[model samples]
Target chain A: MRRIHILCVEDEPEVLEAVVRDLAPFEEVFPIEATATADEARRVVRDVILPRGELGLAICDHILPGEDGVSFMVHLHAQEATRATRKVLLTAQAGLQATIVAVNQAALSHYLAKPWNPDELVAVTRRLLTDYVLETQTNLYPFLSLLEADRLTERIRSGPLPGDE
Target chain B: MSIPIRPLDRIREALQSIPEAQSEVRDFVTGDVLLREGDNPGTISLIIRGEIELLKHAEDGDEYPLGTLRPGQLLGLLSLSSGNASFFTARAASEGTLLTMPDDRFVELLHNRIDFHQVVTPLLLGNLVDRYRRVVRLHLEVAELTRDLNAEKRQLQAAIDELEETRNRLVQQEKMATLGQLTAGIAHEINNPIASLSRAADLLHPQWHKVFGEGIERGLTPMFRQAFELGVTREPLQTEIQRQRTAELARLFPDLPRPLVRTLAQVNPESFAELRSAMQRVPESVRLSLLSQWAATFEAGVLVRNVRVAAERIGGIVGSLKSYSRQDKADEDAVDLRQGINDTLVLFGYVLKKFILVVDLPELPPVRCRPGEINQVWTNLILNACEAMGDTGTLWVCCGVRPPDQVWVRIQDSGPGVPRELREKIFESHFTTKQIACARGSGLGLGLAIARGIVEKHGGRITVSDAPEGGAIFTIFLPTGAAPD
Candidate 1:
């Protein structure tokens, strides 16, 4: 089984800390990566997260220093390697049109408005990551307690693993 | 003597019917006077042909033409009625014929013949009535013309008043625009310094704490820690509490100066006994210096927090101003009106602190608009509500989708409701019910007018009505689709 990576991108240092801190509990299952800009997130995805681990989830802020989060999500959706990644937009001020585009074009999985509750963010991240893992991964034992354990067990029993075939 | 052609024929026919009355036909060349002013000319001369000019003599010895009479018109009829001198001189302007009847024969015919009196009396009355009717018609025509002239004058005055109002409104708008530009510039210039000050304060807090807590072992470090802890938990002392604390500190440290004791009291009013005990442990020579260092460190900690708070406030104001003005940006963008309203509230936070404010805004969809201008609309409305409420009242700002394709924001204030008569006038530029002094101090009565302008530009409508909870309710409805160019 390959390890999965969760990426967080934000422009403000303080906000970025809060976001990564909230995801710290899940680091053992999926390593959390941080970047300040969309361009930096792109570099991390291509050069680091993709080569070593499967990119499973990304939490992005809408406004960045260069190439905003929505465009970055669009670019990620275009690439074949990162196409299955779960996208979440966490922002205080994304306009309606941009959110709509992120939903329709990038297949954005969840939206957490800023000043978000830590529990809510963790719950949504877990759910989206579970969906991604169930669709792509061959083994689901590591994420059994974090996700719907019975459903994953039934899937593992009923279907052959991609590696087994 | 001259006569009109038709009257001569009429006189001739009347004489022939009488058989006893006599009349003579006469001819005159041009410039002959038929009747002269102030001369009797007892015989009646009727014009049978040609033209005669009626003239009045001015005191300046110049004859002014009164009118011209052609054939069939009679002259010297005035003498027939007055039996005295004529009032106007009638002169023949061209050669003409006349029939002259002497006064005695005319009188004799009028008295003896009943038929003659009957024919002449009615003809004279008919002529008089016709002249009177002409005069009456002329008076009526003059009255009608005067009425039309007055109406037109009133219309002209109204147009002038409208023009003056428009000019005043434009001048006020120009002043407000200039003031807005100045505010934006000042806000931009202050932003960087505020950020740096807040950052430095954040950085200095931990370092200052570490040095005061551990850098020194014996020289006032422990006292300083106690003072800092007290300062953090203590409520700000009122004047009475502070005075009592100062007195107690002075009594405890009688040898020290009163100001120093007061400063120590301010920093750590609850830790005064501990401070006194610590001071006794130190040597007499270094006692004052240790207490002074502790007081200074405690004061420094409090000052650091104050500076950070003040800097953050300035930063918030600058952020609100930047968003409100949308400086260095194009006019139109995808704008969240809810965010704009929040920014306006932040700008007005100082004023709103005195009032009970309830802002119930759900997540709203963004609309394409001039964000800065829309923000100004929110600012104006919220400020007006605050001003109306004065020192204490409740203000409610509620926003929601109006459904189908529109979004609406309603701002309500618990002030004296807008008067029924003034509801429409309040949105008009320069129309204010507030005193002139208040207007001069706060605004030029253009706030609502400008708000209406901005809303209308975005294909929206603003309305005001009496609120259910007293005061006024102002509702703004904006279309949710792409704005028409």
Candidate 2:
């Protein structure tokens, strides 16, 4: 029965308002927090707001002002701490390239899209939170340390690095 | 002009005696590699019996069948003009005989001797012209066949893409439906709590009233006690509290009747001055009740609105989907090219809204056409024009009546013109300038070809040429008066 803190980042104001209003009725839910700029978002994630174990999850906008959601998540993944929170990148741009990169690189949970139904938003959040809580409750560790040495080999074959040949 | 000449039989006998001319007499066996394509530089083969097949070598070293050489036909004459190495391999087919004559001897026989040149040079030139025309015709025929194949490929791909789009749309729809059902269930689940909240608000309204009335009664009784102690009447203060409570309660519960009017006037009449002091707090109590009721009402309103919207939205969405999913089943009849173009352009209104569309369609009689297919053609062309413009640019469509009774339509866009290298094969299968991800879409190179096929089927032709304004121009000419009225 613990409250989950969600950080949402988006560009458009109307869509943000709709999301806030839709989720307002949940008394158990805190005021849905949002940010516009990816830089501000990164700062929120690192230094000011989230810190270590403050924020539970993040739903980021794929297309943003400076750094897109994928690149931003890459930065988050690089951080030593506070990288374990579940991440979902919401996008309107079709195709799975950005989604795949963001998910695989950052070990993200799922992707959601714009004009999405409110129920879907809740369901995705619930599922993601459940996984996070399960891992934490059971004291399970999930990391990609074993695959780091073989990164270059995989990149030459399939990763997004240039000079693939 | 007067000269003595040998008889035809003597000339034939003399020519037959030569070794080079002897092959004109026998049948060549199968698998006989008669003459390597470049073996004799300008040797001509005269087929006397059986057949000789001409084969051009494909880049993969495979021999591609060209045309066959029949009896009494001469081959290799084209080599005279094309001194470059022969581009094909020649094989003796089915026991055929070919007389291979040296280039120099054949030239001499036709030029040096006046009688020989007069009799033979004209025949050679005539044969050369015929061969030239045949090659030209073959090239055109091959081009047409290629165009047909490209069109078929595009249509097949379009059907596949449409099916995929439908599948995706259906999946999205199903997800939406499931979401809607879940929403309804949630709304129903939450409704009970909202009703309980309203009931609690109702029960607290009466208790809140007593608290205000009792407080006013105590305060007023004290004031009266003090007044009596000082020997003064308390009627003025008592009347004041009664008036204040009525106005405050009306304002607090705007939707409901004033609570003080019913409670103070009918139920409690003891110590009117004391009751007035207690009624002062009645306004604040009623305000609290109103706030609780408002919250409960707001929640119920949202639940009902959300479910209603989900149901209504699903119907509108399914309607749009039904229209988009029907392939090859669109209504067909005589359609105005202009109207069809406009209708097709509707799908790309977002694209056109950013650009200036200049249409110069000459007013003319409507043409009998396949409405849906023609609409697709116009849609593809217009969409292409919009894409070429990228974010913003100009698009021009010119239509008029061409000579010999044909309707001509041309669409032009101000984008980087088609590259010269790509112009020839732009209508070829799977050819596209769009990135594979955003390729519009699965079969882009096929659009023009499909358009060309539909136009041609209706006895028309479609062509692409450089636009006057330095962009690509697509021209469609449809034969007028369908099937002779």
Could you say which candidate leads in TM-score? 1
Candidate 2 TM-score over all chains jointly: 0.37
Model 1 agreement with the true structure over B1-485: per-residue lDDT tens digits: 42222344664577557755566778988999888888998786656788888899999999998677666555677788778898889898999887677777777878989877765565455456546776798799999999999999999988986886677656645654665687788887898798788888777776776877676866656667666655434444443354467667668667765445545666653477677777788888887777777766765665566567768877887777767766424456767888889888887664565577898999887887887678778888888887787646888999998777789999999998898898889988777656664522356777898789779978999999998778999999999894434
Query: In terms of DockQ, which candidate is strongest?
Result: 2
How much is A81 displaced in model 1, in angstroms?
85
Candidate 1 per-residue C-alpha lDDT over A66-136 given as tens digits, one digit per residue, 9 for 90 to 100:
46789899999999998999999999767777788899999999999988999999889888888998899
**Interface root mean square deviation of every model, in Å?**
21.4, 19.4
Quote the chain B TM-score of every prediction.
Answer: 0.65, 0.40
List residue ranges in candidate 2 displaced over 4 A: A1-22, A25-30, A33-85, A89-94, A105-107, A112-165, B1-331, B335-368, B378-417, B434-440, B455-485
Total clashing pairs for each candidate: 11, 6
Q: For candidate 2, what is the DockQ? A: 0.04
